[model samples]
Target: MATAAQKPLTGAKVFLMLVAFFGLVIGVNVTMMKLAIATLPGTEVDSAYSASLAYEKEIMAAREQAARKWQVEARIQRQGDGGAVVQLEARDANGRPMTGLTFKGTLERPIDKRADLPVELSEVGIGIYRGSASAVAPGQWDLVIEADARGQRMFQSRNRVILN
Candidate 1:
């Protein structure tokens, strides 16, 4: 059988291929970065320098907190109406139910800051506290809690719960 000779590759074809490949790569990278930045809510502190300035104080406070040996346990539950409630219990290191502490929490979607829900908890019985939030769409939620005694911070805890 006789066959026609194949044509040599042209510079324009190679350049076009390179352009398409690089264009796809760059496009995908840009899209991913945008999605990451948009979804990852950032910065626990507004000013990093200010936080660093107080770093020692924070460290000391953490040390003191640890020395106190207070323990806090938190739980999130789904209510029948589709809303959610947070239940918390506090105890001393020796395992006694702690009392006379004030509690506050926030219900937030990790990816969306606009859905943040602030909850003020009330002590129901002894060291047990209960707080509720309005119905939230089913997804992963972050619960940040702080417990205070007198006018000082006693303990802090975070929990992630999936409602669904």
Candidate 2:
């Protein structure tokens, strides 16, 4: 009976195997890295150092805002045209309508900063502000409401909302 001769393992073959293994590992790592970078949502603050430096100021502002006891209600409704409408009502602790303020609303996607939509609201009636954002995708969003009076921020609030 005759048997077929088997090929012997050589240094060159071992080197090729090692190179192929490492190549595959490197390829997968690069692809994963690309995906991660593409999907990465940048930091909330532009500069963490700067934000930290102003943390005390932010806290003070928040305290002042709380002291004012402003009642700011915000609603985001999805329109049939794939857009969204923002309605806001502001009042003081005494139930007086908050007027003479500039209202701004932002619809921010919880996961992607790039999907943030800014709405410039105008007072449709005293204390009632209305605005709209075009082409808003339906999903979970953070509604950031801010009211400014005399060129200074008077009230700020963030609320989570779901849109169908």
Candidate 3:
């Protein structure tokens, strides 16, 4: 039988036991936190990169849809006189004519100092726009055409027109 003189657990031993239990709990908590962080997706550079990739895909899809919905074609030929004729054909995806579309054309000659011409398209027929004025002494002129249709902007292939 234990005697009354036998002291209870000393203060030093109780303090040491408490410290050990707290240290073990802290260690386990830290380990769990590390594992969670490793498995979860972080809001850092990787997240930003993924978002940008999605945005680029959306933009590309919109561009392709616009191209298929609207069609713009151009032709340049010599007139009976010394002037030139510039004709444009605009159509929808279904090959139907698109009418009442605004058109703008610019003829630029970088080599020549005074050869820049800008003209508005005239309505000729269904989905057809024509320019009456001839290019001024055209030599490697860049012909630009712009149009607005269905809330989308359509442009023609930059044609290098040669006036002979």
Candidate 4:
């Protein structure tokens, strides 16, 4: 029996194969780089030096805040339109309602800081604050609540919350 011979391998075929392989590799690398850059969250602090300098002050402030023994509670409820309703209650060490405080609430995304939403809370009842934020996507979030009195921060708390 006679058999036909296969075509000889040529330099052009080898070069083309190499080019196609490298092109695919480079294309995938470029796509991955773009995704990484787009999803990256910038530095937590603008300047490391400034943050370091304020570390001591932050510690002192935290100690003072803890010493106050303020009882603060925060609640978040998911809305129908991808928003959230925020409610907060505060009390002093003696269980009396903490009054005359300005409250600010923030819903921070765990992975993406850009998705953070700030809620402007207002006092409806004494020590009872309520606010809402629009365009809040559902998922895990860090609820940060801060209370201020006389232009000074008096209480602060951070809690993890899930919105379905």
| All candidates in order of lDDT, best leading | 2, 4, 1, 3
For every model shown, what is its TM-score relative to the native structure? Answer: 0.69, 0.93, 0.52, 0.91
Q: What are the Cα lDDT values of the candidates?
A: 0.87, 0.91, 0.73, 0.90
- Model 1 per-residue lDDT tens digits across residues 65-160: 899898788888888888888889888999899888989999877877778888879999998999998876788988999888889987776788
Q: Model 1, which residues run further than 4 Å from truth?
A: 1-44
Task: Identify the leading candidate in terms of TM-score.
Answer: 2
lDDT of 4 by residue, 1-164 (tens): 88899898899999999999999999999999999998898878899999999999889989999899988888888888888999888999999998779999998988888888999999999989999999887789999998889999887788999888
Decreasing TM-score order of the candidates = 2, 4, 1, 3
Q: Model 3, stretches more than 4 Å misplaced?
A: 1-66, 149-152
Q: Tens digit of lDDT per residue, candidate 3, span 36-81?
A: 8776644334587788878886677567757678777888776766
Tens-digit per-residue lDDT, 69-150, candidate 2: 9888887788999988999888899999888899888999989999999998999999899999998887899999888889
Candidate 4 ranges with C-alpha deviation above 4 Å: none
Better of 2 and 3 by TM-score: 2
